[model samples]
Target: MSKVRIYTLAKELNLENARMLEILDGLGVSYKSVSSTIEEDTVELIKQIVAEEGTGSADGEAQAAAPAESQATQSQATQSQDAPEQQETPQAAQASATAVQTRDDVAPASKAEIPHRAPVVTIMGHVDHGKTSLLDYIRKTKVAAKEAGGITQHVGAFEAQTSKGKIVFIDTPGHEAFTTIRARGANVADIAIIVIAADDSLMPQTREAIAHAQAAKVPMIIAINKMDLPQANADKVKTDLTQLNLVPEEYGGDLIVVPVSARTGEGVEDLLEYISLNAELEDLRADPNGQFSGVVIEGKVDKQSGVLATVMVQEGTLHVGDFLVVGENYGKIKAMMDSAGGRIKEAGPSTPVQILGFSEVPTSGEKVSSAKNEHAARDLIASRASDRRDAEGAQVLRKLTLEDMMGPLTTVRTVNLILRADTQGSVEAIQGILARKESEDVKINVMLSGIGAPTEGDVLLASTAEATILCFSVTAPGSVTKIADNKGVDIKSFRIIYELIDEVDRLMKGNVEPVFEEKYLGRAEVRMVIKHPRFGNIAGSYVTDGSLKRNAKAKVTRGKETVYEGTLVGLKRLKDDVREVQTGYECGINLDWDGAEIGDIIEASEMVEVEVA
Candidate 1:
């Protein structure tokens, strides 16, 4: 007969290896280790012993059952049928109440103290900066190759086991379009690993990642990637990071910096070790037997599987058949799968698992709590809806603009906007201008901002949020416009900075007439540049479409990205300076900035006042 491994037999019996070994020792059976092999007869003996013990325990529980205890459990089950609000009290109160409850009680043994689980780390950085690459190396999966254009468009949660300990990583998209997704990652993570490319140093997305982590108030660890490249400069990256208040520990700052090469798996072990150490210091703990709670990482509706939501267990264990109340939606867990896509009966804290049972897709970051049953779940959802209505009723109705608030009693009106620009700098500049327009009566709420033309997804989001889409130097395609129109979403495009600001100003004033517009003047393409001794780097270019004039408002573009938007400081032809250079003519242009590069396009336009009927 073939010998069976002790660990394999333990798994078949649904027992821990350690517990199996203890049973063997108690039965006077010899064993070497979990990997040691045993005769078939020995396996049978172990199984028999376990079965006998389980049966004995069951018999004892039956004998110990009393009429009074049974009545008490029945009474508690009746109390649970009351309004869900009474059951959703503070965590401490629930824990204390559950501590005395028996298995016969209607509620599961939640609130029981659980051991420390793995730390969840959020990986965030700039696009093409190796955020996914690092996670791919750690997880030994080719997730980057599977992504469209090698850019992660959605949030992904993965679990990896290192020599030090196990860690759960939230791989947030590095592109600026997924700001909300990245923020959700940071909000639920125990730590944030801000991945910065060594060659690129710092980019706009990197700054945004850092800001999100800071806003979440989580400890951050810097991983300087691409260290294998010859042009990689880790020191320069560190120096730039200090400007953002992220001083490295070596430089007397609290931040920890690790130089890593995702291509070669260099410094990866050190990074994992640092994460383990940090998690130890934080003393992360949860009660697997405590009240079940989780956060919705992401959710989607699958045709075959129904509604699937990736939930990270925050407090207790989530089990199959457990009733869950997520936001205003509730469902019983029909099935559960771990990060590895394997079916799991239960998941503990820090474990990311996809659960099937939600009636509808719950928004990301919604709190997930276990319910007693389907009836309780429905009650919870209805109660939450009622509370929301009551809260709205208590607040004064918001007016459209400041002019509508003429009485002594007034309420602030919120104007929600979705901003899309051609570049990150344009988004920042427009946001700065909008910030100055906010007052007590008019509050500006930017729902989302990104760099690119608006897409169908943007339209759907605006439709759900009831927000206006503002495009700055970017336009929506015909298909996107059609969707926006069908969804009844307003889309506004602007070519000049002041024109956009002026429209927003009017919107806040309850009067949007006499709209300010920009007149299209000319456009110039930089053919070459000369480093003049006095003017720094001058862009010598030909007028591609229109004319360039001195003191005319100009915007520089590199490919599809806007580099700068300001007035042209100087425009000259050969030696003498000229006021305007028309199409087919070459001119040397001097701008306030020196970032002019070859193939950059300089667009000239002036803000003009106009009226639209």
Candidate 2:
């Protein structure tokens, strides 16, 4: 046969030419290095040679080329037969061949199977800061118009078909529920649209939403809303966002800042387009074959339907008749409905669907899963329920402070508290008063307390915390009240401190009787020395407000300080121990202060009443 040339045959067929050359050298086959681009043809010739050598299929001309394949195969077989001598080489060559074939198969399929799903966008910001309004504007929906006072009351996710594509928007009360969802690290958003009022700039909930987005590491787009307002200043808002490290896209950064007016529908289209562009850049995708997983957006018990829940499917497919376990409830999927209220048999990845057939309402933000069967679902639900109870019990045990140990032992009774005030200080003062109530069984926890109006956060926290919200000198946004009713979180508002305290005390005591108390009126700065028998020397003072009555209880305070506290032994105008001293008048006050001195501030007051046990 014309010179075996196994290396040349290997090169023509694009085989492992180097390995073939090594085998040929080992087998003592002769070959010459030829200048040619015939590697593919050489590999084919080698295949024919191997087949002809085995089955005698090739005639004389083909047989001449057959020895290369026969020799290479025989060489490889011999290497394998040689055992320890060529063991590593043959195994390495076989592994290379297998890897090359696998790579060739996997590479083409991966590129062809790129995912294309709808972008999930969560609308987040301060309560009533125009988050719902902006979503309504972009979706061309009238959610705000239907709401009692242009406010969204519940967590809702819907899809809006835009010129670019279908965009999914989750509209939750831009308050506590949003934070709770993000805290679990199950961010259902490909992009977070932070809605900020142009006139209001940054507020508490705005800051909280920004923190939540950052914690979830979700890309954010700042929507400077209410631009149509007379007080709206978009530039000021941009500056505020920059301070929070959200530099705008135009400022040579990635954050897209869209100025829009939800009331007037200005720049909403541009906002939608930006969202689509961000989603495109992210290439957000989810695997359809993975196990079904989703976060509960909203859930409730319908008098007619039993239990209803809305869930956003993050992965896999959920079908009708699929058993699901959600929080404490388990159910067979009776029906699946899309956001538009259209009944569907199945929902794939990135779809938000309202499901029916749950035995009990699942809590918002809880994860929902598809189980194998009813028995598995029931078992999983029961297990989860026990786990939750154990966890909550442990948390309650951990929350037991020293106050709980020494507090009055009373039966546990759920008390709903609604809290509101004009300033942070007053709100804190009232909340502190309620929170410090001494009761072992009855815990005085605040459901929600904040400055300004009764927000959606107050209502949601109240619902989840199982406590009535107390508002002081603050009005409830009409929509918030409606949501509170819908969510079953009781709320009450008050303008006076005593009235609020009285109601809370009555609730804790299971009675409507008002508790009485003596009030402190004035404080005095000691300016001169005075005489006293029990204590060596007293001090002359000026009444700051109201009147300091003689023999009344008083507390001594120095420059921005409290030194001593006792009953006022005597109070005198000039030389007489007067019954009382009013404002703008100087008097000699003999306190129980052991070390009386000049320049001491004495606050005169009395203990008229104590909290009844």
Candidate 3:
């Protein structure tokens, strides 16, 4: 016969293990440790006995009704149990049974199931502020004995056993890491510990982290770390926090400020104590017997374990044998392990565990839940995947080149552009020609004109104005490309003059690709950098593989990172000027820019577009 352990039963009933053993004292209920099993029939009997004993008190009856699965049990039982002002009456049992229904009959009904769980804490702040050290100290206490330096290296989540209480700390690399998770819609953190280096006070990333924590509406705790340093200034850190609206409790504000030297383990105990006190007031709790559901911290393939998932349980208990679906992947929990890598058979709310046996790796921060069976898990995965496919299709942009002539714009459609070029004269000429194309049907407007590559500010302006950026003879920085991709703003670059004008005409006419296409020609290696007193920096070059052409568009790169992009001003074979230099030949080249470093590479390309019939 199927059975459950006494500890599991205790968890289901929201009672301590000893309290449950006390209630189960009987001839049939013989057991030793909390892990001892009891028959199913005996489990039901214990529930009835508890119901009988609990009916004497109103609060007990309301809580007892939680075990009932029916229309009647779905009502205001939670409110009655929570509201201390509520009085007990004989009708409390029946009233609790249908409290959820009465809300539907009287007012518009909304259902939300919020159970208590361990506090989900995310550590944030500027990098090198001892965020890692403090977390390492807390972790090593529960996990190891002697603390070795640099033991912490981005383990997603870990549980620490402090004297006050246990806390699940989610360590983030930095504020950007925190925001990346936030951008994915994971608001699992209940409290954010903003670690600030005492001597440094608050940096840009610190302020950004503070704003993110506040935006998430989670309470913040200030940790003034590196207190062991001679120049450490805790007062200055607190003052900076005050400017950001996070005033320390000692400074007449509610925010708790703890000074700690993780290096020496000073004041670290106080921080843990405050976290416990705050958790008590937060009243974190969870229904251990309810449906299993949680958030996925991360999922990836493991060489030894196939697909491994780090899960943070929010409600109910997750057993090893239970089947679950994470995002589009479904699996039965073949094995379970805690953050410490110790084998475990079960995971409770707020506990982070490694789950094995997923068919495929799910996205990080995905929602995870228990399914009734394998088929149910598969069905849930199928439905979720279909929803995602539809949503993604709607958001994808069709790769529209600036030269691609779109159909006549709608009355509200304004072809706003932020124009950039290598010279102010070029910028003026482009803006003048674009302004001339303005007509009754479509408007070609330049929102901003400048003589440098398109910047993040330009991308933001384009995104706000619903426009594209057309850069002439310049390259957008790497940062600009990333932001442009995220914001869905088009950034197209061209070197030739007539090509830009032709593309503008093409876009205004109809949907057509640019008349002139680009062709990659050659590459050259800068073996030496020669800076002339009058003439700009000259590159002693060797045609690496492709030929180098004078007056051709070129990009100067330092290793994999780009330094500058412009036309090659001049190319020389020995001392004489040349139009092109072939492969294996050594030459001297004058690039448009002056910051040419040794070991830089220059790439040459040309514009070549065949007309389509």
Candidate 4:
């Protein structure tokens, strides 16, 4: 006969090993440790005994209902116990019977196998893609109208009750700066809704959102908004999505594409129906009685209140007065408010609530877990701090570079380098020469090219990105070099631009095998347009990433389509001519393409050869 270990039995019965051992002792069973095995007969006997003991109190009311009938039932139960055939019920059947009992009736159980909960959905897409608008229509609120520039700046969590069921929606920002925030939202969500503009199809940010959702491994639902517009083209949106491997259900794939008008509340009901059906098929569930844990969706310091944190409880129920250890901080929950701003004493799994008791503003995406008491919370915090200190002391930071590779390898296709020069003009000239050195198989990426001596910040960035620092007509301070040496970052100084270009060319072809590809410089968003008489349409833009270069090959992207592609003619800061504009700075850009409008993105790139290992 097969035998089961005592510890395994304890786990199946949801009882502590120590408690199980005590019970075994009381029942006169031979068990040395939790690891000891019990025969199949003994296991069944133990299960039956435990089941009887568990339901003894719960059956008291029934026993009192009719004494004669109860006595008769007891006699029958005793008779059934003696019958070998009656005792032949499968172990699984007995376990199922035990699960039907409540936690109050059965002691030491961890969680319950019960009803499934609603799914948590995250809405993500490109800028001005109507993500917030769809959510606003669903929740019957003007959340989109309240934001400046009609764009969401941060992540917002809210619960919506639809005809299908309730869904917790996390509306993430569409801007490029909040890429991390969007990924965090997807990580905590069960399903992701990729909102696409029906007229515009898919933009760069929309593709980024799709990538984030795919990385998180969550099911995606495409929501094509703005269907009420005359220019709305759902078919085009679907065709574009197929290029990203998101085939629609109507096309015989599993993906569901819903075309809806956020302004008129069209096809939203069908979207919710599909979401609810998907959740049902997925069988998404959580044990509310399990250990309380959650993820912080967003955290911020409020001037009126203290640290306000929006957390989505993943498991168990959170009650008022419960002490929580959020990231490195710990505090007792003073108050809890639901998505609708209503005060709540308790919150269960899949519920998003704004809590007001964190010691400090916890970082977004930090795990939130409950501690047994205030002392436990403090102890956890102290232990975490000590662990971090020990790890930092023992950790050796090293950034892997092409020079680090040994022997012959064919994996390195691109070289990541940081460029620093004495002047902007020198930096531009060196970049221009490097751009020409690119081949079909090799490409060089200037991750950071700025005008100044290489500083500690540049060294740190190089170390983190595993990029070599190239200085033209500029030097790195001794302290910065020391730090770079310690971090295994390379700092190469060159007096001439040709020397830097030759080094890159050697690394690309001579030192390593190679090919040339398009090197993306940066992206800028057109905030305003100046209709200059002689200069034509001048795009007043803010650099969002990297740096916008003057006289670089640029493209004006209107939504998913590129409207214009040509060289940028005029790059200026106010009236003064500038060779480049860095991130966070506003400048005037004049390209041969005059179709650049407010909200359109301008991308700058150069052709360069990259090494192929």
For lDDT, the strongest prediction is 1
On TM-score, the stronger of 2 and 3 is: 3
lDDT of 3 by residue, 1-613 (tens): 8988676687688765656777777544666445457889888988887777677677766866757655355446666677848756769867886786544234323222445566888888877888889888887775544244423323379888876557898855455545545555666777889899999998845765675565567877888999999999998888887865666755766677889998998988878766765675566877665677788777778776688888888877999989988767788999988776667899888988888888888666677888989989889989999999988886585555434345434553456666789997998788777878877887775655667787665665555456678889999999999999998888889999778887777656643444677788888888898887866888998897878888888888887898888898898887799998999999988987888877888899888866554
Better of 1 and 2 by TM-score: 1
| RMSD of candidates 1 onward, in order | 21.1, 20.5, 20.6, 23.2
lDDT of 4 by residue, 1-613 (tens): 9989676787689775656777888888875445457889888888998898789957886777799787999987987888757554578777877776544344333324555787998788877889878887887742223334342223367777765568888765442213343323425778888899999998856765675565456788899999999999999998887866677865656677888889998888778866876686567888777788888888888788778888889888999999999757887889988776667899999998888898788776778889989899999989999998888876656444554542235554677678889887897788788877776566777766677787665665555456688998888989989988997888889997778877776656545334578889999999999998998999999999999888888988999998989998879998899999999999999998678889999999877876565
Lowest-sum lDDT 10-residue window in model 1: 142-151
lDDT for model 1: 0.78
What is the TM-score (0 to 1) of candidate 2? 0.47
Candidate 1, residues 1-613, lDDT tens digits: the string is 9988676687689885667878878878774445456788888888899899889999888877786698999888888887556765588787877776643334444433447788998788888899888988987832223333442222258787775568988755442323344333325788888899999998866865675555456788899999999999999999998977678765756678899999998999878877876786566778666678888888888777777898888887888999999778888888887776667899988888888888789887677888888899899989999998988776657444434432223667777678899998999999999988899888887766789898665675566555678999999999999988887888999999899887787666645434467878989888898999988989999998878879889999898999899889998999988998999998999999888988999999877766432
State in Å the error of residue 443, model 3. 31
Clashing pairs in 1: 110-289, 110-290, 111-289, 111-290, 111-291, 112-289, 112-290
Give the residue spans of candidate 2 off by over 4 A.
1-114, 141-155, 183-185, 229-231, 382-613
How do all models score by TM-score? Answer: 0.50, 0.47, 0.49, 0.50
* Evaluation by TM-score, superior candidate among 3 and 4: 4
RMSD of 4: 23.2
